[model samples]
Target: MESLGIQHFGAFVLACIALALTPGLDTFYILARSGREGRTVGMAAVLGINAGCIVHTLAAVLGISAILMTSALAFAALKYLGAAYLVWVGLRMLLARQSARQPTVTRGRGLSAAFRQGMLTNVLNPKVALFFLAFLPQFVSMQAPHPQWGLAVLGVSFIGVGMLWSMVLAMLGGQVHRLLDARPHLGQWMDRACGTVLLGFGIRLAMQRQQ
Candidate 1:
């Protein structure tokens, strides 16, 4: 049993790393925002994402994710909520008008706001919850052992891997932000690009099948 658990843990680590590396809506949003807002905001976003991952882990452990996966109404409700949140974020970005002459505030209460944004971005996405529901269970051997414990460990591993990946992304985005800060037009373009990507994701999420 110990050997099996070790093997399962190893496989779970590999899978979590792969998932973390894969580009997703969260990645794009964080990268773009970090490039525009600076490392402080980017790190805040990463922290928020970690917080959301904790929620996902908890949901998986508590079987809430299974309820969401099996119930069409619950899934649809969450799906729409996620979609709406993304669209709202995009709209907010589109409406923002920052002047080039205004001094850039790299350090402010903005980090907290960015962190909250990151949390919402992940927490609202039903697909992420569903992904955990489906993916984590596949790793647990129901007949061989304690499936719940296996799932819990795998879920926590995924969150840890995701946080590591997001931090790397945030650092990269910060570098880009430094390069682009001198060019307000470039910053504006980045904002627009992020808004577009977010809007697209929201639309795509809305079109997803409830099942």
Candidate 2:
């Protein structure tokens, strides 16, 4: 693998960390659900999100992302599906606004269900796959030496950053839930906020250009 300069590596790490902190679908879903259901569900969402990241990593490594990227029909079809899913999720949240006056928990098959939800959310979103294909490769230096190794390192780093940041968010959600548990009105508002944010992200993802 090619050696990176300290400055380049530092910059890359910072950028990745920032990306992780940004509120995306995974983040919003985890935080919102965590606040409502408790840490267990939040953690489940985190696991699911990471699982999705793994899929992205594998797709990028195997060159499946390239195929999706180059094919217009495939890209369009995936994009619409992802967009529709987001819209659907958003609509669900909006409709639930009045009904969400009180926090209610949905029984799952346990953490496995949460993890699956997280993974599916990430995996099903074609934009995420495309993101890995486009974003992670930029840091790799193919001309330097072992391009594959470099890509591997970058991909792994992205996943690690995502995992760590998500755990932190999950913890925060738990804390916020505790703080707001006594205040149902505040909790309701938080749910609305999270739902709105998620809806916006879904829309943005749908409208994203393949290029």
Candidate 3:
């Protein structure tokens, strides 16, 4: 069942599922949104994140991602921009004040905001672009007529797996939030914890060197 010059298609998909299952920044971000808001918003965020992944896939196919690997300045600029955005989002979360009686961001607005935030959080990360550039090549058939199609297929497969995992995280987070809903302060504490983690991720990303 090989298509688009993709070798070991089954293995590639399995690898993608494993990667998606691994706990990373994306997992935390989706869970946080689900816990704080609802599953719907979290799913919206998932869509946005997938959209960003699509951008990376296109970049990989078009050789744009190669620029990040070859150009240190371009890599550094994107890295810093992503880190700054993460830090800003973290700060906003940490500084936010919401009572049990008060809701944060109306439903409609929140959905759009979540989508944008998720997209930006993903699109700005240079690491993802680099990962796509490096990872896709390994699975492509060396003897393929057109290697780019294989890259695109692999990229889409990975993104699809990741989106499904994120949806699961959203549902689970929502359930957990429901269980803890009685304690308003607990929700606040949860936000603080998520904020701290997000802040830490930003710092870590900022400190990361191009490898």
Candidate 4:
């Protein structure tokens, strides 16, 4: 770590842990999936989100994230796309038709769909790219031997912490789902509630300005 010019390693870990614990879109998304589907699908969403973070980390290393930071058009385009996608997902959930059959935990294609949704949600948000560009450098020494590698390490560490937290959320959500499984209407209510939050998050993302 010293060779790579990373400073305040302990502090960085703590910050990452704190951020992971904080409720955010990722947390909501994972919980929604777990509560609606099952733990397996929720874990899939967690992996997808981490994969998206990896993409952002690579963009930071390659300086692609700089375009989002510098170009308003590019940023807005991604922001709108992300907002639209979120709204679409939210609407689907809100408008979902309850089946006559008893609802069970989703599997198979559902897992893949959850993963894709998580990845797209993370990837389309331009703020996340900007965040990596802005946040990761704080712990990296400007005089580091390999600044790019330093960023990668820090990014991976952050994602690792986040994954751990996300897994816990998935488990908790799953337990909630299990408890509410017998009450199908309650699950529907949970779906609607989650959908409403997602819609609000989308609108907030659309209204946010670059800082």
TM-score of each: 0.89, 0.81, 0.93, 0.95
lDDT of 2: 0.74
Off by over 4 Å in 2: 1-8, 97-110, 143-146, 185-189
Q: Rate the local accuracy (lDDT) of all candidates.
A: 0.79, 0.74, 0.85, 0.87
The candidate scoring highest on TM-score is: 4
Among all windows of ten consecutive residues in candidate 1, which has the lowest summed lDDT?
Answer: 100-109
Per-residue lDDT over 1-211 for candidate 3, one digit per residue giving the tens place of the 0 to 100 score: 2556778888888899999999988898888888778788888888989999999999999999999999999999999999999998887777678784466432236788888989999999999999999998888875777888888888988998999899999998888767656666677677678778888989998999998
lDDT for 117 in candidate 3 is 87
lDDT of 3 at 62: 93
Regions more than 4 Å wrong, model 4:
100-108
Could you give the candidate ranking by lDDT, starting with the highest? 4, 3, 1, 2
Off by over 4 Å in 1: 1-7, 102-109, 144-146
| Local error of candidate 1 at residue 139 (angstroms) | 1.8
- If both were scored by lDDT, which would come out higher, candidate 2 or candidate 4? 4
Can you write out model 4's per-residue Cα lDDT over 66-176, one digit (the tens) per residue?
A: 999889999999999999999888887776766524452232357898899899999999999999999999999979778889998999999999999999999998997
How would the candidate models be sorted by TM-score, starting from the highest?
Answer: 4, 3, 1, 2
Higher-ranked by TM-score: 3 or 4: 4
Number of clashes in every candidate structure?
0, 2, 0, 0
